[model samples]
Target: MDIRQLARGTVEWDRLERVFRTLAERYDRTVVRVEFLEADNWLSTPCVVDDEWFVKIVTRQNALVHALLTTGRNVGAITSGTGGFFDRFETPLGMVEHEYEATKRMREIGLNAPRPIEAFEVNGLGVLVLEYLPEFETLEELPDEVVRELAPELFEMLATLHEHGLAHGDLRAENILRCRGELYFIDATRVLEDRVAETTAYDLASAMAVLEPRIGARETVDAAAEYYGSSDLLSAREFLEFVRFRPDHEFDTTKLRSEIEKVADLDRG
Candidate 1:
């Protein structure tokens, strides 16, 4: 099967069920209503899931789900859930299963993470069933002022994680969510606890990388200070200075100044 079909966001249930049978086989265990989170392709397909059970398929637009499908991989499809969402990857089931375990670990440490319902594999693909979180806005969606206000809270969350011997392997803007005045770190799929200090530094650096740009260096520093009552935490970025995914920390200011001076000299000439 072509991998790209998963991202097209237009797979009908009848066409999708041939390889893996969820509704046909586990009819009673799955949710009856299947909602489509997307609206790209709807061709008189009133309800492919509408059969003996009178089920409705619903779809919700999700960036992570889109990301998984864009790679054109379908390890498994979940035909039942909050809205019948599915995530499949060409990668091994082991990788996806790590996400489930990470979520549980975060939850154990008093951090908010969705619980994993079940996981299965089909056709050499990994399919995960995660608890559906209806509506939560990521830190990426919030305004700068709000981010500044919550900066200390963000730092505290990182501190809590480190204290529990864990690190948010994939700490980024989109993974941190705010719901009803409380912040919830949603995507702990990459959460793990090896090299506690390095991982802790990684989490702090990642959060600061995002916050420093939006709220400026001083306010970001203040946030960290508010958490630990010391500026030491602000320097956590040094531990991950060379991380490829992270932005440079003015590591070349002198070089940048030299180039600027050269351009100025040429313009004057």
Candidate 2:
């Protein structure tokens, strides 16, 4: 069994059944077909309803796990000489609501994201509904050449978020999707509103980490340099080691740091 599955403890069938029934009633349907997905994450149990809506069932256990992860991330941030910027939600509803709003906000600002349907609690479980993208490829699943071609576009999208005083607190390759040749971001985590600058730098660092293995470190930095300035790169440099510590991320941090420093030096010169 996957360790993530253990961490994201299974929800009782009776409770899940209640959720499905509620969804069917809410959508005015007599029945609904649920297709459970083996999505790799500890935050939520994901599924598809009637092949139209992507649904996430957030339980109390998921919320507890999220709080623990948030603490660890904040500690990493502090160790990186920055204050904690990641926010924690005490309840499952908060988690689902935040993602719903985040997706809506991203689309409002002309960024590519899933169409959020709604977030509501049912029998103490937080249920989130969104438009399902039937055909898609995560960045990790795509070919290296395809990732290389999309590297700059990824940076541009991140820049657009920062320009609007927002940040994608979680930016693993899994959260970025490609559907029909267009990029779509999903599962944005909540961050402290007042620390947008810190979150932006951390997001830049995370993006570089995701791309470095698929493309090279130099190319990764070059893609970022197009949308970010020397100061932004320098700020992101502080979070490179911190981002490396994440379990989901594996990249050559030393080489990436060197590339970022070289570009920053050139900009300074």
Candidate 3:
């Protein structure tokens, strides 16, 4: 279907406008205009509506929708893109369909994720409305205490995903959202099956790499061990081994080991 039709298809433009309006009113703000944010590596053009909310228009070839965000909350609708690689990739509408389905399935399995509001297809573009989370921060910038609290929960969720034979293709700090003492994962576009263990390991390793510098080695190892509930998942020795395995990435294990020993001592004390 065409862009106009898609915009007014499953979700009537009137209804979408109302939603945006309601949000504006509820937040006591006004959106006078929509501005273009960064477009490229995922078409994300945000409409600047006053200072309260930014209506992000994200589109792929066959799918497009506006993601509404307040200064504090991220919530909005999914829509189709009007141009770019949509045609070049010849990406079937099925990819979007699968993504929403996977997200729902993950939620059903008790995974921490954004709540899906609604999903439909218009003019070949798939769209989903999801809960907007506010006052969230990325895991990369979180404090050690916060990371300690989040680590086990995240690992538990990862373990569940592995147990259920699912994997989030792009598992990274940016994709994880933390709000009000809870963690919510976003961006399930690359969900896959049959490689859960490998995928989980890769994600864990990636998270460790990102967290190492910020958290230091010992606390990092302690957190991993605590999260995995087994020294085997990532013991201090194993962590050192893993670091050594990748000489290209320099890490200080001496400090890490000391920290782990200190944690152990604390536990005993």
Candidate 4:
């Protein structure tokens, strides 16, 4: 489907109005109304609301809102004229569709992720509303013990996806949520068509590189290997190799790689 049609097919404005009305009635509190919030050259327009929840309208040419609606995070949402790789590619609605499909496949495999509530098209926009998760922090901010306890399960989830020929385009710590002693994967955009081993390996390695500092290098690599049953899937050395290519602005990755190598060497010896 064309981009506009894809946007309109995802959410129904009437349905959104009904949903908002129901939420307002249930919450019994006036929704905090405000203009769009802009930061870092991005804008999240407040579209609809209730006291505890509201729909954020993001204005961009891409299907980022649709992806978030289907996959459960807003990582793909880009800012116009922000200047980067995103500026060159037309936001493909197919990506949004693929993410939704991936999330459905993941749920079938018993992976932990945010449950998608509903998807609909509203006023030339694709909107997805999901169960709001409260009181959670991204894995990036969690403690090492938490990462050790959590990383294995998440890795297993990734392994399961790989087995099914699926890969999360972005698998960083911030895309993972910790709630009530469990981790939930979010943001399934960039789901590609290829089932190549390198695709899956890169995903695992990238995730390991991003999380190593929080979880430690040895634990990160070991957990991934253990979960995938392949030491080659993401080794400490491979993680270091990949880190060097990452842009300097990726401070977390640069720092974690340094720290993880020190710990990994000690474990090896």
Candidate 5:
């Protein structure tokens, strides 16, 4: 709808509530019963309904722009703010469709991600309902010892997602969870469709974005490599590069290609 207005600032709380109400009515769910998952937060807020489903509204413009910009460059289209940028994500509804499809695709390949429940669009916001998998704790919530033991397992989860031809675009530690004994990846919002080496590489590099701080970079990489097995491994130097130039909502990867050069260097040695 209003591209200029939306891009100008963050979505206001009152406005988001209003938008949520309008969309919730279409689902025949009462707004009063829903408790906002987190308040005083900046990004999308997911609400748990009867502890069975997690629902949220998202436009994911930044993520969509990254995809468009990446694909555009390959075809040599205008990078950002050009006709292509706005044209691609003109409908937040479409973005939701991508996320829904991504979620379903993950389940199709036997990956442990929340299953999509229902989806709809009202005005410009897209509404999504996902099956709730309760009793999960984020990677940040674990003790150092647990993180050390789970790092390899965490890496394998990502590896499995990749091996099945899917890339969890948002692999931040918070998006990763430990429930029971398994690692369940949340926020498959920015999954990759290209399914190429670069897409998978960018996904792993994004993994480094958070893993480095909590459990140390090289340690995590080595552990992940042990389980990842066939997929490429990141060295200390490559990891350093990932931190600097990892993918973002901005859709720039000039640094990612440069980092790919040193993957063969084996910085560990």
Candidate 6:
């Protein structure tokens, strides 16, 4: 068994059926077909219902994992010379509710996101429903040329989020979806509103980490330069080592630092 599967535990078949049945009753449908996604996700069991709604079934185990991840992320923030900024949830409903609100806020800010339908608890599971996108690809699955083309747009979106005092506490290739030539963000985690600078820098570092390997450090920094000032890039540089500690992020950190310093120097000159 995969370690993550073991860690995530399994939702009993009867419980899952109860969830589906509840969904059907809530949506006024006589029946619904569910297609489970084998996603590399630690927090939820994802599925598509009747090809119309994307759903996440969050269990007690998922909430435990989320708490653990939040602790680890907060520790990483401390190592990067900032206080703990990540928020933790005590229940599956809290996790789903936070994500639902975050997605709604993204769309409200003119950013692309799946439209949130509802979040509710059924049979001890947190169920979140959203509009399903039939066609899409993750940033990691896109071609290098496409990623290069989208890099600046990615920063533009991030900048807009930062400008509005919001941060995507989780910014990775998989969390970014390219659907029909537009980018859609998902799975934004909660962060402290009072620690805006620290969260902003961390988000920028995560974004560059996502792009650096595919687009090269120079181009990644170049893309960031368009939307962020040299100081913001420098702030992000502080968290590169911290971001690298995560298993999902792997990039040439040395090269990235050099590129950022070069850009900073040019701005200074």
Estimate every model's Cα lDDT from 0 to 1: 0.51, 0.96, 0.50, 0.52, 0.58, 0.95
Residue 88's lDDT within candidate 4 is 19
Mark the regions of model 3 whose C-alpha exceeds 4 Å error after superposition.
1-92, 123-125, 227-269
List the candidate 4 regions with Cα displacement exceeding 4 Å: 1-58, 63-96, 229-231, 234-269
| TM-score on alpha carbons, each prediction | 0.60, 0.99, 0.55, 0.61, 0.67, 0.99
The TM-score obtained by model 4 is 0.61
Give candidate 1 misplaced runs (Cα > 4 Å): 1-20, 23-91, 189-193, 228-235, 243-269
Q: Give the alpha carbon lDDT tens digit for every residue of 1-269 in model 6.
A: 88788878889999999999999899899989999999898989999999999999999999999899999999999999888999998999999999999999999999999999999999889999999988999999999999999999999999999999999999999999999889999999999999999999999999999999998999999999999999999999999999999999999999999999999999999
Backbone clashes in model 5? 0
lDDT of 2: 0.96
Order of candidate numbers by lDDT, starting with the best? 2, 6, 5, 4, 1, 3
The positional error of residue 120 in candidate 1, measured at the CA in angstroms, is 2.2
Superior candidate under lDDT, 4 versus 5: 5
RMSD of candidates 1 onward, in order: 12.5, 0.7, 11.9, 9.1, 6.8, 0.7
Candidate 6 steric clashes: 0
Error of 4 at 36 (Å): 8.4
The predicted structure with the larger TM-score, 1 or 6, is 6
Which tens-of-lDDT digit does each residue in 5-98 have in candidate 4? 4443333457546545544445574544422222111112334332233343322434554434433212212121111111111243343334
> In candidate 4, residue 97 scores what lDDT?
39
Tell me how far the alpha carbon of residue 128 in candidate 6 is from the true structure, in angstroms, after superposition.
0.5
What is candidate 5's lDDT per residue for 1-269, written digit by digit as tens? 35433432254577577766764576677763555664222234457765667777665654355455445433321221112211234455765676678788877877677888877775566777888778888877888788888777777777777787777655666777787777777766543355345556656666655565566655655665575432364332233343344233221234433433334345443
Candidate number that wins on lDDT, 2 or 3: 2
